[model samples]
Target: MADLIEKILSIEGGALAITRDTAAKLVNNLVQNGEVKPEEAQPLIDELVARGEAERDALREDLAAQVTTLQNTTQSIQTMLNANIKEAPERAIHELVLLGEQITNVQDRLREAEKQVEENTRQTLGQAQKQLRIAQARLVQATEEIRTGSIDEA
Candidate 1:
């Protein structure tokens, strides 16, 4: 149970990770329930923030690499055109169109990757928020129980 809580708190904003708000609430509930120490929340929050930063850095690097790949493909196509300078204009144009098609294909794949990342992040954040709400409800119930001593007494 402790391991699971720790794992939940560790998730950061990313393709398949939770938001910082949700993570903080989860920790808050665990602390309220005596499952975790109140003092522990700060360290966990710091760790999650660091993880988010790292994921963002990685995503930026991946995007830059994709751009570099597209640039290289474009350069290759240009080189091919230069090599075939003696070819008829119509044939050269056809080759250029084919190369452009290849570049477009790459763009499509990158777009798909971007969409997947976006959708996954949104879903994960939603799930985390839902879980936090459930945890908060549980905390409220526990508090009411303490105040009333028993449902019958209330």
Candidate 2:
């Protein structure tokens, strides 16, 4: 049983390591393909990793806290049921309302993160498009000069 647990832990750790490496590779590829500036690549990768880890940590903590809160609420409800409390139903309703608000807050944060990623992608694509246009123009100018004998072939 101990060995099995160790194996499971190792696999989980490996998965996280793989995820971090994959994120870094993606950023490096973007830099190599000129979609991201070379100077910004490392910092971008670092930020990506940090954000990912932070988000994962936040989610884990949130889940644990929610579970704990629910357990406490369940216990409280059980106590109320045993005691025949008059306000039990209202208290349960209040707890559910608070849980709904928490869910909404999490959803809002997720939407904001998604929007940030979308904006960054748009900026990168815009830069790539601008570079392509400049390269295309230069190619046309070079081709025209060669055809007009302005640049003689060696």
TM-score per model over all chains: 0.43, 0.40
Question: Candidate 2 clashing pairs?
Answer: none
Per residue, candidate 2 scores C-alpha lDDT tens digits across 12-82 of 45323435576577667767888778787666656556655776787799999999999999999998877
lDDT of each: 0.77, 0.74
TM-score of 2: 0.40
Query: What global local distance difference test value does model 1 have?
Result: 0.77
| Candidate 2 segments exceeding 4 Å error | 1-84, 152-154
Residue range 46-116, candidate 1, lDDT tens digits: 66656666777898999999999999999999989886775668687989999999999999999999999
Runs with alpha carbons beyond 4 Å of true place in candidate 1:
1-6, 9-18, 82-154
Minimum summed lDDT over a 10-residue window in model 1 is located at 9-18
